[model samples]
Target: MKLTPFLAAAAAILIASCGGSNDALDGPSGPAMGGGAGAAGSAGGGTGGAGGTSEPQDAGDSGEDGSNPDAPPGKTAEEACKTYVGAYCSQLGKCSPIYLQLIWKDAAACEASLVPVCVKSLGLPDTAKTPEFTASCGEAIGALDCSSFMGRKVPASCNPPTGPRADGAACGEDGQCANGYCATPLDQACGTCASRAAEDQDCDRDDDCAFGLICSKDNKCTPYVAKGGGCDENHPCEPGLSCKGAVGPTKGSCTDPAGPGQACDTQQIALPGCDLNAGYFCHLVTHVCQKMDLSQAGEACGVVNNGYSACTQSSMCKTNGGMSGTCLAPANSGDACDLVDGPYCVPPLRCVGNVCTELDPAGCK
Candidate 1:
C-alpha cells in the first residue's frame, strides 16, 4: 500500500519525537546491526531491554537493534511518508501493481511510523531533500505498479472480430453477444453451455458393477457401483476396496470370507474382492471359502490386539517384538520431553542409575 504525503509527515514527526536521542543511544565500536554505521561501545551495562543495546559482548557485534534502521530523521514530510509506507508494505506478503494503489492511499499513515528510522539512517538536514529516501520509495512504488497485470489474460478486444453472430453462438460479455441472450457478465469467459450429466453418478474406472450393469464409458459420467460389488478396472469399490488390488494380477482379496460361524479352509480360495455385497472368503478353522461380512471380517482380521488402527504410512504404525500397534502421543506435546521426531513414545520403561532417564512414560503406568 502507498502512504499519503500527509500521513508520511505525521509519521516522521512521531518517529523523530520517539528516537530523537539516537546519538545518545550508544552502540559497540563496529558496523551497525542492520548494516549501517554507528559509534562503538554499549548503550548501557548488563542485560538491555527488548530493542535495547548493552555493552559489547564480542568483537563482531554490531549494536544495530531489530528495529527499523532505514527510518528518516526529524519531522519532515518525506520522513513521514517513508515511515507509514514502509510499515504497511512490510505487512503485504508479496509486492504487486495493486500494492501501488494501497501505497497511494495510505502513504501518510506509514510515514507517521517510519520517519525516525529514515532520519537516523539518511542524516537528512530536512525530510524533503532526502534523495536516497525519495528514490527508494519511488522505485518501490513504481516496481509494484508496473508488474500488477502480468499474468492476466488479454481482453476480448485483443481477439480478431468474428462474422455476424448467430442466435445462440458462443459469447462472453455483453459486447460480444448478438441479441444479448449470451451476454453474461462473469469474471472470465462466460455464457457457455452446461454439461449434460450434471446429476449422474460419480465413477473413476470401470468394473465396479454387477453382471447386468455396463459403464457409459464416457469420461464425464459413469454408472454407480454399490458397496462390495464387482466393478470394472476404472471404477472403484466402496471405501474398503481400493483400485490397486481388486481381483486380478494387482487384485485384492478379502481375508475374512465366511460369515461369523463359517470355515475358511482352502488354499485355492483367495480373499474376497473389495465389493462386500459380492461375497467374502471366510478364514474358517480350515482355510476354506465361506461367505461372510467382508467389511467387518477384514477389520477383525486386520486389527492388532494393542488397539492401534491400521494406517498406510509406516511412521503411523509402530511395531515392537510380536505386539504391534499405533503409537500414542502425550497430552501436552510441548511439555513431554520424551517425544520423538514424529511424537511417538520412546521404547523401554525408565532409566537406571544417575544417568538421564530414557523410557516410555505411558507404558510404565
Candidate 2:
C-alpha cells in the first residue's frame, strides 16, 4: 500500500514539484513595521493600507500654548519618505526575491498612505528628519523601485552592503545571492554564490537551474517534463503534473491526474496522484477525486482511509487515542492543545515542546 501521504511537510513543498518553483521572492523579510525618527510614530498597515506618510505644513510650527517659539519645522514629504523608506529598506535585506515581488505590488500604495503619517510625525529625531537623510534615503527607495520589482529578475546589484554577492563570492545561504541561490555542490566550500544554470547546463543542485527548470538525474538542467513525460522521486513533475505507477522515477511517467469532482478511474488510487495544488485527492475506495472535507472546529472527522478529509486545509483533525478525531483551527501562542504534533500553531507562533509559542522576531528573516 502507498503510505506516502504522511511524508514530511517540508518534502511535500520542497522537492516534489519537478525542480520546484523558485521561491526567490515570496514576501517581505521581516515584520512590516514603520518607526518614526522622533515623537510621532504611525500605526502599521495590514493587508491593504501601508499607513499615512505626510502631515499638514503648519501642524508642527508651534509649541502647546498657541505659539511657543521652540517648535520644529513642519515635516516634508521627502522627510517622510526618508523615514518610511529607510525603515522599509531595512527589512528588504531579509526578503527573498519572491517576497520582493509581493512588496513591490504593495509598497508604493503602502508608502502613499504611510508618507502622510511620517510627515505628521516630524518631531521625530534629526536622524530621519534632516534634509541630508531625506535626500539619501529617498534616493535609495527610488533605486529599489519596489513598483517595478515584478518581471525583473533579481540582479547582482540587489544585495545589501554594496550589492548581491557575485559568483565565487562568500555566502552562507541561498537567499544572499543576487541570482537567489548559493551552491556548494557536493563536498565543496559552503559559501560560494552559484548562478542559476541555463537549460542543458550541468549542475549539482536544483537551484543552479534557471527559474522554472530543474536539474535532472543526468545532472543537466532540463525543462520540466510536460504532462505524460517520465518522472520519479528525484525528478518529480512540475506543479500540477501527475504521474502514474509507483513513486520512483523508473516506475512512472507524468500523466494527467484526476481533478476534484472527477473520476479516479483506478483501483490503486494512491499510486495515481491528484492535483494537490487544487486540493483534490484520490479516494482509494470510491476511486474518484474527492473534494476535500471542510470540517469546522470541533467537528468529527477522519474516516477509514481519508485522513486529510477530517478538516479544512487551514484546520487540522485532532485524533483521539484512536481513529476518531475533531477538526480544530491552528492554535495561537499560549493556547492549550490536545495533541503534541498538532494541527500546529498559527504563524509567528510555533508548536514548541507541545505548546504554541511565539517564534523569535529574527525568525521572520
Score residue 157 of candidate 2 by CA lDDT.
22
Lowest summed lDDT across 10 adjacent residues in model 1 is found at 39-48
Q: Highest lDDT, which number? A: 2
RMSD of 2: 16.6
Q: Write the per-residue lDDT of candidate 1 for residues 198-291, one digit (tens) a residue.
A: 2234322111111112123343233223334444333322222222224443433323233423333222223332111122322324333323
Among all windows of 10 consecutive residues in model 2, the one with the lowest summed lDDT is 48-57
The per-residue C-alpha lDDT of model 1 at residue 22 equals 16
The C-alpha stretches of model 1 lying farther than 4 A from their native spots are 1-224, 227-229, 232-234, 239-246, 249-258, 263-316, 320-323, 330-365
What is the TM-score of candidate 2? Answer: 0.41
Where does candidate 2 stray beyond 4 Å?
A: 1-224, 247-249, 265-271, 304-310, 320-324, 335-340, 352-355, 360-365
Q: Kindly list the per-residue Cα lDDT of model 2 for residues 1-365, writing each as its tens digit.
A: 01011110011111111011111111110111111011001010001001001000011211121222222245455564555345443333222211222222234433443343334322222111232323333333334432121112221222111115566765433433444344532211133555667777885544455544444556776544445676554454443445465433255666666666666543222445554433345554666666444355567665534533434322455556655567566565577432223444432233444555433211211
- What TM-score would you give candidate 1 relative to the actual structure? 0.19
